[model samples]
Target: MTRRTLMAAGSMGLALVAAPRALARRADSHRERVEDLIARMTLQEKAGQLTLFNDPFRWRPGNVNPGDFDTDQEKTAQQIRDGHVGALFNGIGAEQARYAQRLALEESRLGIPMLFAADIIHGLRTTFPVPLGEAASWDLDLAERTARAAAAEGGASGIHQTYAPMVDVARDQRWGRVVEGAGEDVLLNKLFAAARTRGFQGDDLADPLSLLATPKHFAAYGAAEAGLDYNTTDMSEQTLRGVHLPPFQSAFEAGALCTMSAFNDLNGVPTSGNHWLLTEVLRDEWGFTGFVVSDYTSERELIAHGFAEDDRDAARIALTAGVDMSMQSGIYLAHIPDLVESGDVAMEVLDRAVRRVLMTKAALGLFDNPYRGADPEVERRVVGSPAHRDLAREAGRKSVVLLKNENKLLPLPKAGKRIALIGPFGADRSNVFGPWSIFADREMGVTFEEGFRAALTDASLLTVVKGSDVEAPLDGGIEAAVAAARDADVVVLAVGESHNMSAEAQSRVNIVLPAPQQALAEAVAAVGKPVVVLLKTGRALELSGAVKDAGAIMVTWFLGSEEGAAAADVIFGDHAPIGRLPISFSHYSGQQPYYYSRKATGRPELPEESEYKARFRETSNTALYPFGHGLGYAPVSYGEIVLGSETLPWDGELTASVSVTNTGDRPVDEVVQLYVRDRVASLTQPERLLKAFQRVTLAPGETVEAAFTLTRQDLLFIGRDMAPTVEPGWFDLWLAPNAQGGPHTQFRLVR
Candidate 1:
């Protein structure tokens, strides 16, 4: 179904508007129970249901430090017992969650079970590659499996909900939060959103292993001004609808139980209090019935944004704007009751928010079993299990992008060859789990040295040297690295940003290798040994000098616990590098917010054009490594694009097909991407828009036909009136390996 169809057909809350009789009846039953509870609740209790608190004593299994305790633990605990807090976050451990749930159930007047939430961005314990890196694999099933595994582990630890699968369409490599999302393409973001939602919630939310999936930072958090986090975003409504809103819509359609409001302001309004975004679009348009929760202190930040007068005004505005819950902010608890009593905020509005929260808890089966899925035994068996580790290894292996392979120098021999593994990250374990990995254990991780030792029969053949710190010089480090490189037959230089460098609040202006690391790379390359640059990063960094000029370059973007083994697998040819770049890698840092789907300019940059054209003097207009670009052991070739017909009926469909062949001797996986562009439209369209993609495995000398079905729905775009429209016109199509150059054809949409 098209997005419009989904928007119209979807229902609010846990059940469809047009659900089956049995489902409708159950939903009615849940609503009745919630209504009864709400009617008995005092204004303070109703407000409390919309307030979420952080567990001060974040108790873990057998690991509790008194110094790390929240000094306000007594106050928070009393508030919970007094029915002033309905949810808790930042605490893991089945027993701890059970204790908190018992306090709410047994002590509170209403006896409502408390909800538990956490930032399960990638994984709970068995850390997977960062979400951006996972997107590089272009494997929807892999994304789903990793999410499912995380849900199981998190569920076992009594986490009722996970703020995950950040579906923001990020184009700015400098933005630290890009590491948490799929890259710039809306199509990829949409697919991954649905996959992760399905994986986390499974077929039923009541399932013991299922987690309430929250597709978060709702609407355009990625388009921050100058690529800075929490900055204002001023764009035309059409751009918002076309670029930013699609993924959130897609996630809602995929049955995400909840969503978190973004921190940034859209246009002139803060997203926390933007009624159009939170109510009109999310509810009336998309029919997201699940509750909307504010980001950490975002509701209170409305004052900082100058959108609200005070804490009371912030609480009133957020609730009226359709935000059902306040996270890590006491504003709601402090003023919501007074606002309701004084007729500033309606009782109906307050009740509606409370009802939504209650319904969500009911959907998680918390009403039936307060301690559901919080089993200490299950937690012990599941989190960081061997099975999960194996999945992480597979995910990491597929996420490794082979950026350059000069003369096919990779697939190094496993034995006899002397290998020098140089750089700070060669054996570093502190930064493998990229970002938002609160529960990740560095001790569980395998280092590059350990992976090499496990792979090689003669461990003496490999030498590891820390050439430099991530951003500082090490004493005599470069000299030792050079000596090792000279003595070895091959050198694997691992270098990139630490885990802390590419996450929230860590945006950088100079997005390249540190000066010391660059110097180390140049010195090591001067040794004249064949070098493979094993780059570990969270976001795309501009490449230059000897590191970029290395014989082989592999981008391993902060692969998690099994990163080392995964890298060893790719280096030893056990697994071919099948990952593609989800985002563009630019030649210079000046190209902030660069993407493949940019609208065509009046004066386009062309090789044969004059210097006055849209060309940059410092660097090339194109990316160093374009989106969807990657290399494998075996190269794949694409044939001419074949269309079903030159003209397609306005209401009819057509097929775009291409024959892709594995031309080399080895088997390989190839991602065949399909893109489209309208020749003319009411508004200017992007030069090319990614529509469909497929990952196909081809054996040596084997050819396979990859096909995509195209309909008017596929051509739909937000038009002049800010609604989805498809105008009859000629559309260009490309069936290629990546977003850049491909075999092209055209089809006309005729009335």
Candidate 2:
């Protein structure tokens, strides 16, 4: 049939079968037709369609082509024509995506559609707070709903995919990817993952606003050695499936259609080529029918990990192991055909992956209208809309953790305080926008200067001093800044890494604040002024000196463009800073991956010679501030816990409840946490494990109750068989401010 004839026929079918979908099918036969098309494709062709891609942003800086493509435009053209290169990433935006996709539909022999995807992590055009910041909000429902807006805006931008809901558990503050994930609690991660996935993907994949939300890095990429991105992941298989996979499982049950492999290896097997992880566990065990994509260049990196001999071997191992998309490994594009012909890889493997990919695209209506993503609708509604911005702002506020508020030093009277805003982050719009913030507008970022102006009026008379640069030295401005601090009532010392300082491949041997800035803050603090230290960093930086010296410390884990105003509102007492720390603030780098929920060592060191404890010469086992620690202007006190039952069996349930009251004068919010200690187990357990937590707000002198229903699932650990199951034992349940329970109460469950 001629192209015009096919177009007319397709449009006719579209009118009758245009799936404005809910519970009804436009036609069950459409899926079958897609299946038939998949059946007709060759192994190489199918694998090609399953090849995943990122947008142009992953390209090294100033690489004119966006990504590090060497004659890649032409390669893309050939791949599309060959019915290969199924997914696209890292383009300039929607229009660029549309133009690039034409190479697939018009020139490709099969006329199969290409999927356009982007890293719509926080917001599209209107940036939201980073995921870590959003986690601080303790508003899972809101965060998720905001994600819905993100999907709508992203979808409106002609994008059908988002690499989001990065639910990796960041136990180590040094891991750069921590900025992309929810914090260290299993329950929190589950809730955040569900909300974010539902928001990004929407209720139905067929909805244009609903991009295929992919939960990624398959396993823990957050617990990298020294908290570096794409570093080695070493964990027992039992621990892997227990703490890490729960969030992913939650995402899957919520309808995540895609999974991305990690750049790291699990137990010496690279995730991109680990069948035990990709197929047996994620797919076969969990029933994740979605196509799995390798992380950028991961399949090829198999050589680096010593898992594969070369690119050709990597392709064979990856496909055989169950990767649907190569994701720029070039392994598939380079050696898949040879492998298939050599009988090293099966054609059926490629075909199966292709079937899944094409099925999703067909569901997305890519075949009926290949350019469906790049419509004027997306441009009109998605980029920089108020709704999107509001979502981002809310996410940012939620993520901001109030680390200190002793003496009620916060909620500074917005009307009367002579606030002196110092430090580099105070006026930087760039630092607030973390890595993977593609669609967020950089220029519109709210700096601390803007935040102060918005929070405090002309009556407050806010003064500015560039005390110390968060990115670089002040060029000898410290003396002048200290002078400014002495004259002001409050000095807001804004500091942290530069915007580009803590992202991917930006690992550091040291996590201290820059020497110049640290010295500057010390000088300013010596002036005897009350200072609020606002940190704008991607990864956690050492804060022992600052914590010991500053009147207040706030872990602003890189709030986005709207941060200035939101932070101002919280700091100056307009809004109480109720947010809690998502990750711990270690006193020293020796703590490396220090977190509350960590496995205890077999030898469990004693404080022999006083040097055997988990302490460094420079700092203590104690973090500058502990995990789950945060401050509010008004004080909150917890009442005695009332357990529904003191003891329970493995199959039985335990109910833990407590009453919390806002004891101090203004209204305040408190996060009541539940932690447990397994008296004994087959393997070791964390010194303390966070079980349940709830964020509650009460007016001054007002009291409220918080409760949690605990089941066998809540007590589960990865068994020797690698199945998630609970052990038979007595458990100590502790309800307190941090993971460490204030007093021990016994609960028993026998398997």
Best by lDDT: 1
lDDT scores for all predictions?
A: 0.85, 0.72
Find the 10 residues in a row with the least total lDDT in model 2.
Answer: 6-15
Q: Which residue pairs collide, candidate 1?
A: 13-289
lDDT over C-alpha atoms for residue 593 of model 2: 75
lDDT of 1 by residue, 1-751 (tens): 3333322221112222321233234445688888899989988888888988777655542222213434487788788889999998767888777778888888888889999988787888889999999999988889999999999988998888998879888888888889999999887887788788878888777777888888889879999888898888888988887877777766766677699999999988999999999998778876777899998889999999999999999999999999999987779999998898899998889988998889888777787778886789988998889999999999999999998999889888888899999999988888778877878876888888888888887989999999899999999999999999989999999999998889888788989998999999999999899999999888889999899899999999988889899989998999999999999998888988799999878888887875777767887678998899999998889999999999888888787899999999988999888888898998999889888777789999999998777777778888777777878999999988888888999999998
- Roughly what TM-score does model 1 have, to 2 decimal places? 0.96
**lDDT score, candidate 1, position 734:** 94
Error of 2 at 389 (Å): 2.0
